[model samples]
Target: MEKIKTLNFAGYFRNFAPILLLFFITSTGFAFQDDRDFNEYSGEILNNKNGKAISSAYLSLNNSNISTVSNTDGEFSLKVPKDLMDATVTVSVLGFQSKTLPLDFFKVEGTEVRLIENVEELSEVTLYKATNARLLVQDMLAKKDENYLSDESIMTSFYRETIKKGWTNVSLSEAVVKIAKSPYNSSKKDLVSLYKARKSTDYDKLDTIALKLKGGPFNTLFLDMMKYTEYVLRDEMLDSYNFSFDQPTKINDRYMYVVDFKEIDESDPWYYGKLFIDAETSTLVKADYSLNVDDKKKAEMMFVKKKPSGSKVYPTELNYQVDYAQNGDKWHYAYGRAQMEYVVNWKKKIFNSKYKIDSEMVVTNWEKYAGDNWRSENTLIRPNIVMVDDVSGFNDADFWGSSNIIEPEKSIQNAIDKIKRKLD
Candidate 1:
């Protein structure tokens, strides 16, 4: 068996982009020191008509900022403290009718919450008023200061990443970090400090190669396109893209304009995705984009930082999705996800290995920064960070567990179980 080595995240993009750190180590401590007396409410969010699992559904506690997103399995867990048990939790998604229920309605055994698709169409007048999708997006990007939070605040977020070799899970890493979120209108980057993190990797499953995701939660934070315009729609790069309108829709009763965008300049065919814009406020509420990796050479440059001398590695697909939450007229980064898939070929070996890496971060709770009350015992303020459990000497106390997280998909849970078997 090959031992996993500690690595640093190295990202300097000729095209701009990056997730997945091949990790192996079983660190199962609940690292949820979000300063809340949390009582995790667990459930599965589903589609009412098809009864299919609804991934990426947003759940929030009523009259408060606490919220979370459903996992790929449509499973959800919300950590509500004892004082908030009387409050209601609302479940909402892009195309679904939001459902709200009192805390008493949910059962610890796992409640099922379903939402119907919101098929309401846009009036001709609404479409006519916004004929130019590019212009509409431009207007929305311009109003960033007014649409997003303008003051500095502190946020407690949960982050998890998994690595798989072929069909078997090999590595898992998860963390809960404190963010000194900067004002939306400014260019200052957010500062992060690792509050708690854990990882478990199945080394026996790996034949030789190990993958590492650089930057961890810091990279995911930059996915907030509204706050980090240069990361996606820099003024010069905007002209290179073609923007068109898709079917208009409603999210949380707000009139929304669905705009589809793709790179028109093939020389740098970088991304293509959809934007969910709030029609009235011209705010970008959600964005889904992926790097156009048809040119294998370009994909390699963007992701494959390093590998063994004789081994070949190239990214097959890279997809990202960022979601925002509206509290009154202001918005904040709600959730972000990055999925990366690659094919690895060993020089002397006939059989090749396929690897898939996924990482996601969610803002569970936040408050306006009272600068005096803030301090990080183990801070990670740099732009590039690696969370190695053994190297960092992770302590079990206050570490996060499966709660306040996107419930793992069946495959990931199986991987965790397999590793746990060895530990037990």
Candidate 2:
């Protein structure tokens, strides 16, 4: 029996050896450190024209040896080595003009850097003329191939994704997902699976898949909407709504021609928003939009009687604020924040749950292949899934029992695999 148990353990390890190797490699390479080799400095970066805080602006010192980006509030903390006191700090945003300052110029305890917007031909222009120009551009864009609007196939990268659930306003459970190329054959076989610590087991050897269908959520809701320019303006799902360009603005250093979309018909979905497209590449950069849902009406009509007693009825509002950044030549979604507001009415008891979801992806590496052996070579890279337990706002029983759980890595890998199979 002891020998049999040992054999079983060995077999398990063998099955997951590739995934284990990836976890070891990634953990060692991306470990976080608390101690810095240099002293840290704090400051705020703002736009000189409007004096507004510039978020996500890249700042580097001593020729990129030390670098950081400003936070959403335009605040930054960076470490500068004492030896490089004379080195200048450079600040740059996408579409915006870059600024540099000598380290010696800042003598106070903290520094405030102001960046001025580069005057482009569009900056001093009137809104009405810009709208006309943008309308013409949109008309041209809508006539292009709709397929181009939603091609995530452009993203060819290896990344590890993590997902977690929150309790008491903190993450309670977590999971890690890793996807990399196979060693023996890179094209033919791609492995995918999930790991759960609560189960003390790993789900391995699942095949990677992609979606080929044109109208799925991955294509329609995300990719196509993101790659807006790929579709001609006439192809937009505007119903009777009219879209016109407003003004050219800079976001994250990228110049975006802001397009206003409004409803001409009340029957059309509430599609009021602005699309930020890269001025040079014409790629979609960011979209800020909102949608309305009558949750109370839906709940009253759709709720099953068997659900939890004292269940609440609520009016739900879904808000999505999404941003995309250019990764290489393609535009990939970098970060997204979604908020669902539910106004609950439980037997006249009213409350609200502002559920928020934040997600981001960083592509560590990408490789493209156009050969016949792509499928065979794809098999070598195995997927690794790590299940993490959420300890926050949990009783010992809840923590041990498995009531609260999350499987982020599995979901992400599944998404990748689905896309792959569809494409294949």
Candidate 3:
């Protein structure tokens, strides 16, 4: 009897300890499970009138932190707490009236939000040239940030133009470049000759020239000149010109402020034109200006340079135009056009190079890769072509240089490396 009683006491104690531990763990797990359960929904926006997909529309929850934009295909997915079953959702787009609906409007699984068209109020404001337009332009230019001058600055862009004369076309291109600090102290190389039919092919003669440009005088001089020109334009043209503001206009559902500028001094190299800026982002949307090329001295010097037999001089009465579109939270160039007419004098022969060059560049695609703020890997889709016509000259050979003279691979690689340094 005594042995039996003692065995029962130990057995009961051991059984109770395990049971208590198990209960504690089960309770803790249940608590965590409750916190982890969240409800999510996928949805789309549609034009109520047409029943078509609506893209770039903003969607947000009334009480929660969830918010997102519709994709190009007009589709979206969002997650929220299950307890938000009674919350409200709001959707909005520019030029369209906003809509708000209770969560109960859609079944918990997926929802379709309908947006109605909104009538915008029109303003009637007459725009005339302001007396202080020149002064206003100067002030704006002076206030331009110094970051614009840096090679690594995000605002840098590539520009190429094809001048079409009477019948033949040629390429005369320049890029808004930024100069980066380099490891090697090399000189600048000569222009690598490229083939007309296969522009990607580089000429061999430019090999020594390209290598010598590692830290060369030509590159240094070129960069210095570009920076100086930009600085001068911003300080003298933008800061000194007067402007007249016009009524706001709508572009891609964004409000924009339009301003016209005129030069204070006709002799100034400043362009006279109109500028459009996004009211919300304060970013430039468009700029259309006419430049004066009346400086006989500058024009003569530029014309005297023997532009390869086929190449023509830069245009006079140049019209510079730029258009922009939004990319995520940033603004980027959508399209650009530069038209000018120049007189080329080669071998004492007066050749009227009346040229119109246009370039249509678009961001066909983009992707994010690994890197830091100092550097990044980006691929660009550029569809570019150059058309040049010799309005005055009849010789087609004058425009055709020896093809395959420069190594295309080396020239392109060098150009890319130079761009990377500036970006850094």
How many steric clashes between backbone atoms does each model show? Answer: 14, 45, 43
Candidate models: Cα lDDT each: 0.75, 0.39, 0.39
The top-ranked prediction according to TM-score is 1
Clashes of 1: 14
Error of 2 at 193 (Å): 8.5
TM-score of each: 0.89, 0.48, 0.40
Q: Which of the two, 2 or 3, has more TM-score?
A: 2
The C-alpha stretches of model 1 lying farther than 4 A from their native spots are 1-37, 123-128, 372-378, 390-403
Instruction: Candidate 3: list runs displaced more than 4 Å.
Output: 1-160, 170-197, 200-237, 302-314, 345-353, 372-424
Q: How does model 3 fare in lDDT? A: 0.39
Evaluate model 1: give its TM-score: 0.89
Error of 1 at 378 (Å): 5.5
Q: For residues 205-314, could you state the per-residue lDDT of candidate 3 as single tens digits?
A: 22111100011111112222112234224454354666787555655556656778766775534456777655554555566666565774554343222234433344
Per-residue lDDT of model 2, residues 7-50, tens digit only: 00000111113222112111212221233334556677888888
Question: Please, what are the lDDT tens digits per residue for candidate 1 over residues 64-166?
Answer: 8788888889998777777777899888888888888999888775889989998665655354368899999888888998999998997888888878887
Worst 10 residues of 2 by lDDT: 5-14
RMSD of each: 3.9, 14.5, 27.2
